[model samples]
Target: MIGLEGALYPWRFRLVLALLALMVGAIAWRMLDLQVLDHDFLKAHGDARSVRHIPIPAHRGLITDRNGEPLAVSTPVTTLWANGKELQAAREQWPTLAAALGQDPANFAARLEQNKEREFMYLVRGLTPEKGQSVLDLKVPGVYAIEEFRRFYPAGEVAAHVVGFTDIDDRGREGMELAYEDWLAGVPGKRQVLKDRRGKLIKDVQVAQNAKAGKALALSIDLRLQYLAHRELRNALLEHDAKAGSLVMVDVKTGEVLAMVNHPTYNPNNRRNLTPAAMRNRAMIDVFEPGSTIKPLSMAAALETGRWKPSDIVQVGNGTLQIGRYSIRDVSRTQGQALDLTGILINSSNVGMSKVAFDVGGAQLFEVFTKLGFGRDTGLGFPGERVGNLPNHRQWRQAETATLSYGYGLSVTAVQLAHAYAALGNGGAMTPLSMIRVDSKPGTMQVVSANVAKTLQGMLQEVTESPRGAVRARVPGYHVAGKSGTARKTSVGTKGYQANSYRSLFAGFAPAQDPRIALVVVIDEPGKGAYYGGLISAPVFSRVMAGSLRLMNIAPDNLPLPEQKLAAAGQGGRN
Candidate 1:
């Protein structure tokens, strides 16, 4: 054992071996003290002197249309930040940094003074890689570029209302962006890493927190249909010289918003001096009295009473019926002295509709309207959705009930109106609407009996094929069923309604027998010659629906047999 461990023949060799053993033992003891006994303290000391906890910016989610077309995206960008303390001492580097950042040197110095108490200050944000490299090439002290994300909108104004823009801090401000803020903006993480004297990344010690990228979101919007709706709505706005307008289309089967657009739209990318009124999603936020479009729903309500029939006669003597102070009248006697339920709608006779509502009473009408999702939000979860008002049954007077029958005395958002019509077209079942792509089929809620809604659907077709129908709304190869609305705008700051301002609207479903889609077209304050929904709104509806139906590959429901030449004459569209 002695020979294996050490040779002890010479005293010089023995002494050398003994000294070496003592030195090795001392070194091992010191290592044990540091590695086991005082490990936590030693590690903490080393980290305090040489380690940094750097934050990793979380990447935001991408937003794409249902068909995979990108509406909003986040591109990799570099954000230049500076250590205020280090920069304070690098006075000579200020000009080089300021010039690279496109800032006046004096202004940059003043900003540094303002942020002197802060450890970090942003020198530049959202810079291109090339630009960041140039700034770094100048070798400005205390300045570093961080890899971050900046949102980019490819569809621009076409989808501004749906995919709202984010702020400079990468937070959502409006539309879907605001609605899904947390889902799109993920949690940022931090890493414990070492850096050299020049602040260059060295070795990664450990991750304090793992960075999680935001999950991508897919919308229900069809970008192709959105473009079509936007183009048509814009053309109508310019042609009529209208103040504003909006258009919405829903897939009846899915209750998905295929297209939603508003005129006077602004680009989401460059939002300078953007007005709230202009930024508003009119289809979901703006509510207006629906005029005659309510006629179909009213008709459906009347039929639901079991006391009224579609063929029941409504006496129209001289086309006027006086209800105390209100005079419910048809424009002229052009409609027959007496007409059936279908005639009342085809003629848009206020007297006929008022009489029906009077017979049905206020409670029944309210029931049907509420079931159709009026007086409440559509639950689309869209930002700024307005729940329109519906007066309590006790508050509704006889005349008020009469006016409500013809789409007055209460207001409705365009999407609500469309959803109601879509309900009727979908066999009296209402599907919950959504802006996101739902994987499962949405459950349906029964709004009215299938027979009642179906009967109303058939009568609505007469509005486009009868002698007094809205011919412009007729598609070349599809059976269209729809109703027109022309309501006078209530005075903004006064009690009475406006004399000339009107909201023209058309709501309907195509292929009346087997509807696949429902559309709503509204033009606010149309002024060029014609203001009637039949003339202004229906034409836009026709153009948009034709393109949209074709884009969806829906088979045409009407053949080459030309429809009867019709015009909305003699019948009054006013409620």
Candidate 2:
């Protein structure tokens, strides 16, 4: 019995010792794997769990007008963020946070609990400083505030379309903001902070990066001119009972846009009910058939080719010329008989202009129009600028060619047409139109011969002086040369134009002898018993020109009336 007991005890002791050795080996292997092979993975997991990244928002830039009036500015705001796990643990205290944030406690609690696994989450974005301070005062676990910027437009609706606005992230989203986003949007930075086990920021660690503020942008637009144009455009819209209106004033020498005003403008500061149409910069985006305003270009092309003179007479047969299956007629059928080239433009004779365009051929017409910068971007740095549609010569039918000559079939933006007219005013030199005044030498391209331009200027002056012409566009005490255009709005897929619905346009440069400023005014479907450009748009042009000239202190060359001669009595008596 003593021998059996000894043997059993020895066997049990050996088995126990083997099991102990195996367990020790397994523990050693695990230590080796975790401490050596899986060291990096564990270290990363620990770092992710403890380290917090705080985004350092860069201060958004300011946008100023030419005279240094702030159009758009960035004001300080606060962004609320939280550690999801800590926020969920402090769910009972969320009501305090929610009340400070003006959010429902249940909803806020759900949001916090929903993303507990996430290391960080934005509780609220773009909070006012006061509200953010209130939230900070609550001292809720895991809740924190960071400095950010919110865009503010001081001029508000007055400069809405031009200055544009930014998104909640302080990113440029529209207008000049979108155009210069890269230069205006500075580099975003980050800040690292050390946190305790309770998810409280113990202390600020070393700053990982520093935020660089964006560069301020200065626009070429004048605030005074912009305000004046806005007031006038708004008044014109109401008075004429028009659907919409846009006016642009350009510096002839530099092509700098002085003012660009569109009716039905909205406040960029508070865009609660912003419409796509209200956001549109019609001066750059909307295109229309140019009607008689294009006659000067066509006639200039004809004159430039040495094919027609101002005195050249075309016998317009009862103000109608049949081209192919279509017949082009004058706006006024009552006017009859032969009309000279000057008379044709003065009378806005489509028949005579069509005959001249037919004589000039499409190739020459296309070349001239292309040189004037039609069917191409104007490089004005505006958003959504349409190049408009100018059909190629190959695509042009005989009738299309004739119709195009008198400003049909082809379309152009108001800015493009203004630039073209400005070229005419600037001694036949085309300057690059710019909305931002960059310090650089002005580049001028010779589009029309000086002689031809001078002659056309004379003819356009006559167009204003003639009885049936846009005489009302003439500013008193100043020589104003311009043309009025009334085009029927064309419907898509329809063969004909819409009656009673018209686009009225007046394009001119004041002090015609030596042009100073080139302006264009357009009214869409004026309801005040006048859809004619001479009646609607020309008057606005006149008022704006008069005001601009007076403001600029431009000396009137034709001012101071001459004394009436008594010889007129003798002349009348002799007759």
**What lDDT does candidate 1 reach at residue 454?**
89
lDDT of the candidates, in the order given: 0.88, 0.86
lDDT of 2 by residue, 1-575 (tens): 86787687898768889999999999998888889977987877876777787778888778888878999888888898988977777877888888888889888778877889887899898889998888888878778777988998989888888877788778778889999999898888888876766677767877789989999988888888788888888888999899998898888888988888887789888788999889888888889999888999999899989978999999888987776589888888765698899988888999999888888988888998999999999987677889999888666577988988989889998889999999999988999998886467699999998889888888898888778788888888888888989888997688878878899999989788988788999888888787888888998898898888887787885664544345666678899
lDDT of 1 by residue, 174-292 (tens): 98888999999978899899977546568888989988888788999999999999999999999999999999898887898888999889898788878888798999889899999
Show the colliding residue pairs in model 1: none
Segments of candidate 2 deviating more than 4 angstroms:
1-53, 88-96, 104-119, 197-199, 334-336, 395-397, 493-495, 561-575
lDDT of 1 at 174: 90
Q: Which regions of candidate 1 are displaced past 4 Å?
A: 1-36, 195-208, 561-575
Superposed on all Cα atoms, model 2 deviates from the true structure by an RMSD in Å of 5.7
Q: Which 10 residues in a row give candidate 2 its minimum summed lDDT?
A: 557-566
lDDT, candidate 1, residue 345? 82
Let me know the TM-score candidate 1 reaches against the reference structure: 0.88
